[model samples]
Target: MMTMHPQTPDILPRVAFVATGGTIAGTMTEDSKTSWAYSSAQRSGESLVMGIPGLLRRAQWHFEQPYSIGSQNLELGHMLQLRAVLLRLLESPEIDSIIVTHGTDTMEDMLYFLHLTVPSHALGKPVLFTGSMLPSDHEQADGPGNISGAFEFLIQCLSTNADVSGHSAMPFGLCMQGLFTPAHRVEKQSTAGLDAFDGPYSVLANTQWLLSRNALEMSEDSGVQGQFASLFDPTATRHPLFEAMEVPVVFCTPGNGPLRQLTDLLNRKPASVVVAAPGHGNIPEACVPVLRRLLLNGVSVVRASRVIAGGVEQGGEFDALDAFRQAPVQGGNAVFSEAGGLNLSKCVMYERLRVLAHSLSV
Candidate 1:
């Protein structure tokens, strides 16, 4: 643990910053090694902090770069590894806050994963996730301002133990552009704008944002059945990417042509299947038989919408399909529990954690 001093500089909060490569660390290059426009993770976390005007003296910092690849290249294993890093950092008493700089493309996945895996009681301090749409070298890059907002939010959380509006905030949140939103309610609104999110209603850091559903439904609980309260366990051996690709997500497209075949499930039934069903989670009637067979054989299924904003409804298209009673996996205790009111992307994450947690203890 880093010891605190009673002097002037030491009074600034101590921060643990993890830089997982995203556009915020990107740089333009002619090489074909990186994704889309430029090479991400071209810059290091320490360099990002040191280059930011007036940020060098704000805090005592510890930096680590777990990946420098683009966000599209980041996989499930990376998230689990990052979770382990966060748990380790949370153990240090001298650390007042933690921040992760990532790519905006999948920033919500990182944020929501932390929200689900790390509960309030486990948080002695707090963690913030931030990233930008444009590369760090862009003339009007948003990464620096976003990162600055992270530090400002940390100062308030440490000093007042409350948000800018003087209300308590959740342990996991995202600070970006000019807004601060608790992790659970965050959403990316556009790909073209700097202030591209659609939650939180403030210019300064705050968590008074509203949610569409009951608070109780948005679980901060760990794996299924309290499974030791969280998957953020730093000590347990991990199955980071264990069978991550097996839980197939089938998309519901227009027209009733033969849907994608699931003959593979008959031989090696996945623990779960997340269907990105058409409008309001209407699972096409054609695929019903195979799904039912899988269900009886101990495979789980979740119905979700492909639409960006709305959620799938109960009794959507088929009454029988809408109601799900799942069974445990063949050899593992994980269950891809039925849930509602989450977008398709979020549903994928929710089920992944549910089914994956038991493979290796969460």
Candidate 2:
């Protein structure tokens, strides 16, 4: 091994590697590789980040954990705190880049939320998020490799976009198993695969790449989430909804079964409701009347499909009794996905931002 040349300390990128625990910080109670059998949030951020010096040899990693908890228990309050920490770190003169180890389950949600809320001033530095399918100590652990690859990704961004400027938002990507996907597109696909996330490298992704060399170069195409990138512009105003608003999800099931929940939700009268519709976001004929009543009662409704692939398209015709596709209601705040690209979780965040924007304008 040619381990001759030593790395210059000053040349290394200063990375604030924030660990908000997930399987990467997890440890199995018994001697097992089973992902579900493990306890998450067991390790500290320093313990998780310090091991990277041997693999990457590039960045000087600093450890910071906003808090330790599984993604399932992730709440809006935690994310507001995280947004605060990330904005502080990115704006800091000490740090040159950032790599966050977050739970894969709600990682995309946080990314999408941050994509909307993070100020443009903080977008200059490289921000990359990553986590693992297996625990840190597992024999076939992928956290080390994922972390190494993620660090390399930031280096590539710093190298490429050092002089690039004037864009409203800089590149932020999710790295898993060698695939680097943009914030707007990344989604968790598998529960058990070593490489558990996919976007540009997904099997169903439009373009194909070998994942062997150069994923960061492909990231330029994945940069800045077009129209969905900004809402509630931090520079313009500080609307309280950014941190406090809540959008509840309602799933449309077969027949009259969902009526009870819909009735309860109607009584709750939330700001917005994101419905997981059957087929292409189709509201069942039976529930149409109640949905109308909800809409008339000033509860906004946004439709998303339960199906994995194709999203709900607007202006699509529907037969009698069934509510139309992902279109805004006649006189309410139903937010439509400009394109048929939003999934259920995305629709939730999108609706939140839409409500925030609507509130800011008023």
Candidate 3:
């Protein structure tokens, strides 16, 4: 644990700032000044902090880069590597919290993955995520301000011991320009706007200006269940990705066709097939027979929605197919488990399906 100086009691927490390469770490040509025209993953996390004056003196923080790639190109291997780093950090008694500086493109997906896989005991301290719409060196770049917001939020949480229910309820947070959002509820609504995040949920903190002086405030608990809680075997010591890496999977959006393509995908003997459909997880009626054939063949089938929020409803098309049952893989029963909560985002549903495919048969 980092010691606190009596003269500066404020500098009491120890933090780990993990970087996974994003627009927040981007840079441009010496003459270029606009955020739109720049190369990404050019700057290290250390360099990003240095760009923000007085950041180094804020806390006893350390930096580590697992990999540097654009979020658009992020793969399963990269996510697993990041999960490994987070596990190591969260287990450290010396670290009070973590702040991930990433690109905004896949931040929600990344957060959802972490939320599902990371154990509750390991996530005792807050693990927050932040990024910039603009590059690090843009004249009006948003990286520094976002980082500052995260740092300040951590300071407040550590100083006050932010546990409302006598337990650490919110182990992860997403801090943007001036708003601190809950990870599962965060969404990137715009491509280039400074205020690009929106949540149908409540804001955790709204620290507008007064970066150095304002106190952090808490909002009502969103009551988000660890809905995908059964997806992982809690007793397992190794990260879930170890098995997930071996699974060959397919993610597709429903369309007009004879479903020959779906048959081709199943021929590979994949662990599961994820259908990203429209309007509460409904797919074309033509695709149903093929899907039913695949489901009957012991292949796992998952229904996920493309909508930002509100999961799928149970009795609609799913009832007609009689697709109710636990996922064949170890952890979850998949769509058969429940309705309403199953309507997951396309990316999140794909990840859950991956976990299910890799899961050991019970």
lDDT values for all models = 0.67, 0.66, 0.63
Better of 1 and 3 by TM-score: 1
In model 3, the runs with Cα more than 4 Å from the true position are 1-11, 29-35, 164-171, 206-258, 307-309, 323-358
| Full candidate order by lDDT, most accurate first | 1, 2, 3
**Steric collisions counted per model:** 0, 0, 4
Which parts of model 1 are misplaced by more than 4 Å? 1-10, 30-36, 163-171, 200-232, 240-245, 255-258, 322-339, 357-362
With a 3 Å backbone cut-off (N, CA, C), the pairs that clash in candidate 3 are 311-343, 312-343, 326-333, 327-333
Q: Which ten residues in a row have the lowest lDDT in candidate 2?
A: 204-213
Instruction: Give candidate 3's whole-model lDDT.
Output: 0.63
TM-score, cand. 3 vs. native = 0.77
How much does candidate 2 score in TM-score? Answer: 0.80
- What lDDT score is found at residue 163 in candidate 1? 37
Q: Write the per-residue lDDT of candidate 2 for residues 160-263, one digit (tens) a residue.
A: 54344533224465777777666556788777687668654332111222232244232222223433335533233234666577777777776666777778
Error of 1 at 219 (Å): 6.9
Per-model TM-score on C-alpha atoms: 0.81, 0.80, 0.77
> Using TM-score as the measure, which candidate wins?
1
